[model samples]
Target: MSDYKLGLDYALDQDRKDELKSYRNQFHIPKDKQGDAWIYMTGNSLGLQPKQTKAYVNQELNDWANLGVEGHFEAKNPWLAYHEFLTESMAKVVGAKPIEVVVMNTLTANLHFMMVSFYKPTKTRYKILIESDAFPSDKYAVESQLRHHGFDDKEGVVLWKPRPGEELLNYDDLETILETQGDEIALIMIGGVNYYTGQYFDLKRITQLGHKQGCNVGFDCAHGAGNVALNLHDSGADFAVWCTYKYLNSGPGSLAGCFVHERHAYRKDLNRFTGWWSHNKQTRFNMRGEFDQLPGAEGWQLSNPPILSMAAIKASLDLFNEVGMDKLINKSKKLTGYFEYLLKQLGEDTIRIITPKRSEERGCQLSIQVKNADKSLHNKLTEVGIISDWREPDVIRCAPVPLYNSFEDVYRLVEKLKGILK
Candidate 1:
């Protein structure tokens, strides 16, 4: 509604005014056969690679070629401390303290590792709670945890479901669930932003509510990490995990991040799986001393990290550190707001936006429900060089990442949809 117009000129004018417009040049936007750039809107899935990523990765390759074993300590960045290079910038991107964050493992692997420490369920309080529509990987991880703990997976899982016919979750319903069965639930693991609806939950509220009921709370922030202001430390959640391949733009299946609140930084009593990398660095080469677990989130590490993968992460984090989340989020709100405005102009009867209307309650992605449409609609969109993601029955998830996407990309997307629907 901010006096948005339905024309290419308006989008071009907005792009011209965008300070982040220069960033689009940093990425190599995919091109179709005719050499035109495809309107890439799936940053929420796998982010586009930064043009600098190859050079960053090549530096590690060259260091490895020049120095084999000595590269561990002699390389420019030093392989022995590669993960440390990303800690500060990664912490800043997620609004966490340096002691609270570490980059290691894939998303699901970090979830299980975190669960080994956090999901300590007594027989009386063995049930786990999660959104009914959580990503399949998370559901599988939680269910496996229940089975490993000698509990009935089916009976031990409690779902915070949306009301009949609705897509978004209701907080009141979650309160009612906790009020009645809070003591029986040992862990409340939820996606920070529901991937299907693009609805960002109030992490602090959920944490406080779960704590009042004597339950441990954590989040799978795969969808919320770089796209929204998570402020994981301020939320006081027990732990959180997310992948770097999404908004972090660190390539596919790159290292994921784990956040262990400062309160749990030094707790030796926590039951966690550990490996050689978790030992004190100074004594690590001794290979003969007692196991001294490092303090803070790094204590959870199980293996030496891959420098090539960490190189991609370092490349992406450098950009994030330069831009800062405050400015990125400011542009995200406006870009997504513009996408929503254009979709609303398509008429409610023709399509519906399942993502929360308030900019603060969602991120860059908008989940659109086209009336009576099937996956063929998504197929049609793809056929025309628009790259958007399609959820099972009908939702087309489009994310106009402020770092690379432009207002004109969004404008062209709507025009393509209109033509197909007509």
Candidate 2:
């Protein structure tokens, strides 16, 4: 295969012949000082916005301006329960039933809400199990949860880490931890795709292990939601939370989505933080007696959401609806695989791909472990208008989003990196 040439020109030729080339024009690709479109490869952090976003948002803005308070019902796309509009498409993207998913709140907030209900710790089993390399927010959230429940995080929090001298996490370690601390472990919450290493854990296997040990299971799918296929329903996780700003192509800090296994759909006895929005819609205005909670994920809402953010989410989700997630993901596997192939050409000693080689283990983002490189190298790439991201001390992350990125874009990125390295 190395004998065959796969270079920038070859990839661009592929782009020239692509069926989805037209979709690239639909997005507002960011530009540089010279007014050239910057190769945006950081969709793992923040996605590019669709040009139609303005029009979709404008429709709601116009409705709000004219209809005033009456816009709740009178508007073209009524504001009363505007979030419901994005549910079906969002569900389809993540492989969930319409009733099992809801788009609301930010990612971290949804995590806390899900934990409150699902992380039911008994006297004997009160520990929270997570990956050693979980995102900072997740580490903070679980630590705080342990404190809230009168447990010391130092003792109650268990991190399933890889064995000494190994870069990748070992599932055997997780099994070993559960075997030893099963009684003390009340919850197993992991990042479906680790942000730093780009490792996508086996959700079904993890969930099964947690369930066998009598622990509630959930996933913080910030990196997994848009990139990989998270069949949340079949995985049998108690719940999962993800943001739209990344792969979902919703704007920054856009309203997040959550999943509640259909099995827990109507467990009225479950504890949850409730607000007026969580109340029954028909009887909400009455506000007379009992707190009637809406069933499933909607019941988790703490307030009526800011409509503008939801508008952005609706805009992006509508695009997903038009194209369908299956089609996008199928295209994604091929596009991202091509990216992986090119990066490996740089030679293993020069750079290492931390993301899994299998299409099943990753989405679009590839975490490149650049050897003997640091922040300065990242700055050089940025100076040239390549918009990839560097996390902490090393590892440059680049994601060629399927909705907007062309194969030519990935080809150009490799070419740029080669020039920079030279």
Candidate 3:
């Protein structure tokens, strides 16, 4: 691959040689009213729709129309085991065993479910720890969980914060928190990827540290799911939850995925909120039967999932399976490296990347903190059709997804920033 450390030409050349270049056509790239491409750099916010999504979704629609109640079994994809259709491929995407991964409720909802099971707090160890900049949903979920568990949030929800004047979080700070509050902390749940900064934390390290403190550990991998190799199985975290909308490219607000380590699978004695869907499949139809929880992550399901939504997830996972995450992440390293190089060439005095400079610590997203501009500049960029997202306060978050975004897109985005600055 030719390295594009300078301008658009190098980016163009890299795209020419890209093995995954042809797959871009499989997505429904958004277009302006004039039918031009919308410069979609917000894959970190929402991944583009796979062209196959419509067909996949339509398959279920047709089954529903034709089979009626029979669609639960007689259809091509049986609704009874619909979520099962996604397990193998999705297991690959998030690096979990088929037994541990299940696509069910939305992200925040799944986080609450996982917390209910794993965050079993005693009187002394009732505290929970999270990053100060976690997504608002995560913050609220943990706070509510503490209150639900009869712990005062003020006394129970601990913040693992960055040092003053720092943008990126340091692992040392986490260590300090665990050291100081280890005895009191019952759970440690951090975002695998920081939503705004695009920083990918070391899940394995975090898990080990939390376990060292005898705290149950978990992660919200909403940003890390398809963007990085989570290896949740190896990380040994108690549980994890993630969404498919972003790097997973399943569609906006699609169903979320949850992982409950196999270690916890056979523990039927553990507490959980269950329903018909979580019961043994064979006996599920036997009304008035006692709840016999299914094994592994599938046991966590409380209700029948939306088949249409599962179809969309199946479509995206199929694409991920074909290209493979290993190959995709390799390209991501090179592509994001090129973006970082070009941004630095523009000089750090006027702009700075809040995301970590180390390639291993992030995915394709680059959070640029502008020198003096605010949302007005974001509006200007939007006017010119540079479609990146602006988070609160400062930082324009742009993600060049290697799956659908070409190196040329990153080049164009950088050029637009240069033009606006000039």
Candidate 4:
């Protein structure tokens, strides 16, 4: 990584040597009016569509057209057990056992559902803890959960904030908060990778800390799945939820994934809201049978999933299974390291990266804090051909997604950013 040189030829050379270089052709890269590809750096927000997604979706459509209701059992993938098809591949993506993972519901809905089983509150231990600047939606969900349980939302919530003027969170700060307020906290919910700062937290450390306090722990891995090695099973969290739209490359508003540790899989004593889909598959068709909840994460499903959306996920996951996380993460470090190298060359006085400098502490996204710059700077980048996310006031969140983004793409992005900064 230190050998990265500043020139177009260097980028071309890196791309040529990249083992995963051919993956870029699998996606449908966006183009301008002149047919030039945009420097897309917003996979943190929404990933580019896979070229194979259309064919996968079309297969489901064709099955639906021919089989109709019978497609539930007769279709090639079979809608009756369709979500089951996604369980194994997705578990691999998140580093969990096949029994612990399930694909169902959208992101926030899955978060809410996971809360139903994990967020057990009482008169004294009623507090819920989260990061200070959690994604706005997660903040809203936790606050609403507090209100729903008849506690004062403000008093029931605890925020683990960063030190003054600092952007990234320190684990020491999190530990300090738990030490002081551990007794009062019933649940600890945090973003696996902070959306704004792109800080990938230590899931295992947080889970161990929460468990030591007798608090249930969970993660909203909306930004971690398919982007980083979450190792959810090893983290030993009570539960987790993540969307497939971002790094997983499922379409917008696609179904999300949920994980329940194997220890809790057969624990029928745990309280949860259930539906017919949560019942045992053998008795699912028989209305007379009482609710015998299916074991593991599948026990959380409420209804049969959408086949088309699952098909898109299947398409992306098939590719993931082929390449594996080890290979993707290896290339990701080099591409992102090269990007950070180029950004630093712009000068620390001008460009300030708020994300952690260490590769293990972050995924591909870098939150660049451009001094004195505003939204217009982002607009200018967009006008030229860069697709990135602009947070309120100052940060530009750029993710050089390893699956589709090339070393040349990262080089061009930094070059364009340099022009804008100048």
What lDDT score is found at residue 70 in candidate 3? 98
Q: What lDDT score is found at residue 230 in candidate 3? A: 89
Give the per-residue lDDT digits (tens) of candidate 1, residues 25-119: 99989999999899999999999999999999999999999999899989989999999999999999999999999999999999999999989
Q: What is the TM-score of each candidate against the true structure?
A: 0.99, 0.97, 0.98, 0.99
lDDT of the candidates, in the order given:
0.95, 0.87, 0.90, 0.93
Tell me the tens digit of each residue's lDDT in model 3 across 132-212. Answer: 999999999999998897889877889888889998898998998899889999999999999988889999999999999
- From the highest lDDT down, the ranking of the candidates is 1, 4, 3, 2
The residue ranges of model 4 lying beyond 4 angstroms of the native Cα positions read none
58-107 in candidate 2: lDDT tens per residue?
99899989989999999998888888988888888888888889988899
Higher-ranked by TM-score: 2 or 4? 4
lDDT of 2: 0.87
Q: Count of backbone clashes for each model?
A: 0, 0, 0, 0
- Per-residue error for 259 in candidate 1, Å, reads 0.3
Candidate 3 RMSD computed on C-alpha atoms after optimal superposition onto the true structure: 1.2
Q: Give the clashing pairs for model 2.
A: none
Model 3 poorest 10 in a row by lDDT: 1-10
Q: Where does model 3 exceed 4 Å of error?
A: 1-3
Q: Candidate 4 residues 1-422, lDDT tens each?
A: 57889999999998999888898999999999999999999998888898999998998999999999999989988889888888888999999999999999898998889888899999999999999999998999999999999999999999999899899898998888889999999999999999989999999999999999999999999999999999999999999999999999998989899999999999998888898889999989888977999999999999878888899999999999989998998888888999999999999999999999999999999999898899999999999899999998789999999999998988998899899887
